[model samples]
Target: MSKRSDQITLVAGGAGFIGSHLCRALLDRGETVLCLDNLQTARPSNLRLLERDERFEFIEADIVNPLPLDVLERTWSIGRVYNLACAASPPQYQANPEHTMLTNVVGTDHLLRLAERADARFLLTSTSEVYGDPEAHPQHEDYRGWVNCTGPRACYDEGKRAAEAMAFDFARMERTDVRVARIFNTYGPQMHPDDGRVVSNLICQALSGNDITIYGDGTQTRSFCYVSDMVEGLIALMESEQVQAEPINLGNPNEISVNELLTHILALTGSDADVVHRSLPVDDPRRRRPDISRAQRLLGWQPRVSLEEGLAATCAWFAGEIDGGRVPRPTAPDRVRASVA
Candidate 1:
């Protein structure tokens, strides 16, 4: 994934959880990085480590609008463009559905055109939500999906679908070299504690001794991929010579249920929290697991971290995040202590 020392890689949404990690990975490879974000759903602390590197530059701008004048005026040559700019979490994206749709459709167009202008390779971080409430278990890239275009999650799901179309259109028209990654549930350190995702919700609740919330009778299943593993897959797909204008599935295929996930977190956190059940959110996918065969065949990639190991690491990280602001819980487990150390 290394480019020339002087080549710049631009990551939209670089101040967010996943994007920040990608930015650091690029910088570590000796590439100059421009991290662009509007700070809407981004965490300010995500950029702290990146600011110390002179090779990293942060741009404050939203992709839904036209590219900033200063950005267009800049003379630096961009070799790669990664669009991870949209709000990913349901609560965040659903809060402003209109903006979410625009961020995916319009924002994606802005970045693709930029890639077209610079003759840079482009990558879009599309989501598994595109396969809304999918009937297909172990979903593959070719699945047309069963998404509800008018459902609550439609803003993100359909928007991403449209973004993929536009990205491939540019490629088909011979305007941009495009890579589309249909990412599945990803979790790890630096995830916003209140992002409303199952991993964050269950882990934070267990760590804080709050009631564990299980939705949809606790039978709905989802595969969780660790952030590092997902980042590796993303870079591999981006650098692979064989993939272009083709969507590659990127996620861990180890499926676990909502109740099962809470059980693991409770064990790791030593939480005695009671379980609570709630109705599933509208259009929530009952089963989600990527088939990832394309990723393995095309890029020689598969998840390296086991679910138990990744959960232990996430619990340990959240212990520091939640308890650091409150009194230390005496029930904290030793597994979390050892995992972080």
Candidate 2:
């Protein structure tokens, strides 16, 4: 598996949640991987294992600017490109809205041009957030979305939608082989501990035995897709010759409310965590899920891992990382003692 067949894959943001997993898969399938990452939100721990592999090389580069022409000019064959490089988490993306938009818009433009020049098959990891707060229960790929361009979450929502548009344009005008996968909520190991995502925040809070913060009335629903299932869908979409030059939805069909997810995590962790309600952030989606009928029909894909199983695995990974000193253990909140004068 370590020895690859000169099929160089430039994985933008390979040292990332889904991207890292994809890189591992490529390595297993005996394809050489060149991970192009700036390590902004990515953890080096994710790529630590792959560092020793001769076929795997990590290039600390940003796609907002042009790719290193020197590296591209050097004698190394690149046949595939997976553009997984974008600020996904709301807090991270919102921290710098302009950068997030540019990363999606300019970054895609740059990578698509690279794909065209290299004659490589391009795969874009788009987001289901493109649907915004869905009017429907489960969103289909064709849903145009009801988005607020001036909202706080617009950076991610509109950015991804724009990325999809760019991909289609490149596919048509430039005649580049392009593939798009509309990813839904995915969680697994190596996610930023404080990624400000609901799943991670809830899990960590429960593990620390703190109150679980639920935004809104906790009735808003979301579908959780295990990272492995999603990566498989991406691979299928890329490798399939029958489907091309279009967008495909990749996610789980089972939807659960925020309250339900918190209860489940608390039960799994055996933590005495209480539920706390908070004001919902502006433009926060009330409901989000993917229909995935197209994925099943065309790509023959559906999420295989159950939520329970995936969560257990994720919890165990976090536990091990914390215990082994790889990841910091979460600390309980401070308590105040009553003082009498």
**The candidate that achieves the highest lDDT relative to the unseen native structure:** 1
Clashing pairs in 1: none
> Mind giving the per-residue lDDT tens digits that candidate 2 earns over 1-341?
12136668889989878899999888887888899887778877888978878888898888887887744773236678899998688767777788788889998988888888777888999988888888876798778888898888998888888988999998888657899999999998887776678887788777766677788899998899999998899988888877867789898889999988987888888988788788888888998889899889888889999999999998888777767877655432122111111
User: Compared with the true structure, what per-residue lDDT tens digits does model 1 show for residues 1-341?
Assistant: 34556778899999888998889888887888898898887767789889999999998998999998766765348888999998898777877888889999999999998888877889999999888888878899889899999888999999999999999999999998999999999998888766678897788878777777777799889999999899999888888898857899999999998888878888899999898787787888899999999999999999999989999998888887665763233332211211100
Q: Point out the worst 10-residue segment of candidate 2 by lDDT.
A: 332-341
Q: Backbone clashes in each candidate structure, one number apiece?
A: 0, 0
- Against the hidden reference, what TM-scores do the models get? 0.93, 0.93
Residue 115 displacement in candidate 1 (angstroms)? 0.4
- Worst 10-residue stretch by lDDT in candidate 1? 332-341
